[model samples]
Target: MSEVSGPVRVAPREAWLLVATFLVAVAGLIYELIAATVSSYLLGDSVRQFSFVLGVFLSSMGAGAWVSRYVEEALPGFVWAQIGLGLIGGFLAPVLFFSYAWLGAVALPLFAMLVAVGVLSGMEIPLIARALKEIGAPEFRFENVLTADYIGALAASIAFPIVVIPFLGLMSASLAFGCLNLLVAGLSLWLFRARMRAVHWLAWALALLVSLAALWQSERLVSVVDASLFEDDVILSEATPYQQITITRFRDRVRLFLDHSIQFDTQDEYRYHESLVHPVLSLAPRAEKVLILGGGDGMALREVLKHDRVRAVTLVDLDPRVTELFATNPELVPLNRGAFADPRATVVNRDAWRFAEESTDSFDVILIDLPDPKNITLSKLYSREFYGVLTERLSADGLMVTQAGSPLFARQAFWSVARTMAATRNPIRPGAGLWTLPYHVYVPSFGDWGFVIAAPQQHRPRAPGLPRSLRYLTPDTWAAAQVFGSDIGPVEAEVNSIRDHALVGYYNEGWDTWFR
Candidate 1:
């Protein structure tokens, strides 16, 4: 291989080839991201799915690069590789979704698609460099090709979360990029028409036709797969920067799902929101100002506002899209009782951990209504460090509560949250530790879910008087919630911290055991 010692002028043909390299790099990385994201949405663990997808992709790229050595004809190889990539990468998300919907597992298809796209991407730059050399263009160097590839990758990294997922969604984004790959292939075919045969032209045409068709039908494809995954009619579905927000309906019953995990089913959601908010507020010494983290739906906000004493409520949730939906959607507004419109309620779209860390105001009650710690990002919210941050924002006699996972299914995880909260050192009193009360309630939509209430000082939780309209938590049910059966009783578990993330492991294990 000849290395260019000085600046070299590139011809039109060589410039186009480099341009193809950039586009292919963009499409390749996007495909890898789509695979990882789709798997994360369908499966539980985000960290594991991304790690495995990246490993398979990079390894497959290496295999493709090594195999590229055998291709004596570089231009033809490059064209064919792009065509194959366009088809496989374009349909990857739809295929994975359908496979998961029908087969109940996407492991085989997901990894297989990753390998295919990775290997094809691996061949791109090498073949491009070889083609550039073969044409005898002015002092072509491999570094120039690499520079384009890396810059294209940077463009993809920025665009994916900011533009692609938010606007195009996973399935459509994959198909759109797939179309880009085919467009490159078509350009290459036309540029090197003399070098290409009738068969090559036919393949390019067929790939383009197929990719365009898929891109046009992306929404219908998504709906079909969603119908299989969800029991009810999917009335609303959108992928936000943070997670996939889906709303499904059956008759009058509506359900909200984030990343395929059910947030609430409207028919029995009052049972959950009531159980979560009332007990903590009832136990708190003062209920003047309250802070809620991660109840974007406003259901918890509805319950908090039910207390006439709560003068101000601040709700912090990461996704603005979720807050906007519940705030504006007519179907959803009735469920949360238009809590977002309340004068005393303030909705801040930001991470719960960061909000707790930065806020200077003290709250009489803090409610952590976040999703279960199924991944690292969420696990940190359940960490001792996070709880300690919240401790700083709690008034001296204040109380906080978090919705722990199901005690019946995720027994160890529920206990882990309780243990971690109990271990949190009270900032109000240097040597004194926090006090915690673990409890569970049975909601039909979700089975035996658990909650842990903590305070800087020891205080017995009592059911405060609530309105007659309150659905689930009566004094009797609140008393019954504290009584645990032996089967779902506390189990020994490690305290989850920012360093260890022990809770996520226990959460995954316990749920996996039950479902399996």
Candidate 2:
């Protein structure tokens, strides 16, 4: 559709401006989400990144809206705004990734992009409304433009999670949306070329060409950035529905990271796996039915199989790719000792919390081997509600153990987990406080990691004799593991509930201190 400034006016279809609004809305939100996701991935704190990004975007939009009154021309300005957003928003992911990789920071560039996109986006809607008004649709201009904007935002929210993230990934998705914005600019320019300036046509062409090239080379760009981000050679990298999975190899050592948090380093994983499994298993010597939650790597399963008494082991992890990789990949098979292939092992790829709600089966021992409470998704697993679900399935005579994060680094968070379990114990019954004990072991890769073992009632925990040999956790080491220094000892903390997820706040606070 075409609209001219001054007394002269050319009438084009109203649908063009409405469609532009829709496309611009989708493109704007996509950039906002991309910035939030990339920052969370790199920075390890979702709540803070998203909060900051949203604040900057909204403020910039206001600034753009206020500044739009100064421009004499409307159509040209609108076209150039779209092109500018496309160029900056489209290249944002790769630029941010590489910036963090090379310069070790993403804050300045990330916020700058957020501001630019927001301002350009803010300017577009008002210009579109004015253009429609100038073309003799002034009466219902606000209603029409507002409706289109809302519809476009709704479409973007729906498409982002379902289509964009799942198929194209964060980086590619950003580039693709950038192309969409540029296409809108080109389409608008082609339709209204008579009303537009030569600069608008040139801007549209340049933005389209740049976005197309970036989309074509998105994979290579991702690879180059990842190579710099990770010290080791990135053997495999992909964006799964749940998380960003990357496996890196440095000589003989292999490392797996989910969402940039290191899961395990093959060289010293035995120490961690051994420590996680043996403490509770030794106490509950007759554990036959085993349930492994979130230990997708199969290292914990290998440890569970070491006991002759374990008749059946159920492994519940959120990601199928993680389980499948451990089960099939030749590089990882040796590390887990082909645990998933064993007759006793059952691999179920689903949310651990949901599986807990549905499963009727009881377990002699439950190992809660999930990631730390770095984000809300993970924080839910560590909530009081989840522990209550575990309480139901846990055999009265059985014991449960969880891999809590580092006591030294995240002291309050480490103890908050203990507090959550304690708070959850007696919620059902007045006198039913859980028999809980906190212990920790130091692995070379992660220093001063903690674990919490809980039982139905108080019983003397005896470190049982193992059927096979262990690389760590002897009787003396086991005794020393329970000893905590004053600094890393218990703190007065709130329970981590599903609604509040107080653990995430505690975790973010405790961890952020170290960086400062």
Clashing residue pairs for model 2: none
Most TM-score-accurate candidate: 1
Question: What stretches of model 2 exceed 4 Å from their correct place?
Answer: 1-12, 137-141, 426-429
- List all candidate RMSDs to the true structure: 2.6, 4.5
TM-score each candidate.
0.98, 0.92
Stretches of candidate 1 exceeding 4 Å from the true structure: 1-9
lDDT by residue (tens digit), candidate 1, 1-516: 998687666777989998998999999999999999999998878999899999999999999999999988999999999899999999999999999999998989999889999999999988998999899978677898999999999999999999999999999999999999999988998898889999998998998898898889999998998999999999999999899999999999999999999999988888899999998888887999999999999999999999988999999999999999999989899988899999999999998887888889999999999998999989999989999999999998999999999999999999999999999988877877689999899889889999999999988767667767896789999999999999999889999999999999999998889887
The TM-score, computed over Cα atoms with residue i paired to residue i, of candidate 1 is: 0.98
Cα displacement (angstroms), candidate 2, residue 351, comes to: 2.3
Residues 1-516 of candidate 2 have per-residue lDDT tens digits of 797756533245467888889999998998998899889888877878889899999899999988888766777678888888889998889889989989999999998888998998889888888777665653445887989998999998888877888789988998998898888888888877788888787778877887899899999988998898888999988887677899999999999998888989988888788888987888884699999998999999999999988899999998898999999999889889999999999999988988999999989899999988998878988988889889888876878889889899899899988877776664335667677889898887777899998877665767656545788778878888889999999888888888988889888888789865
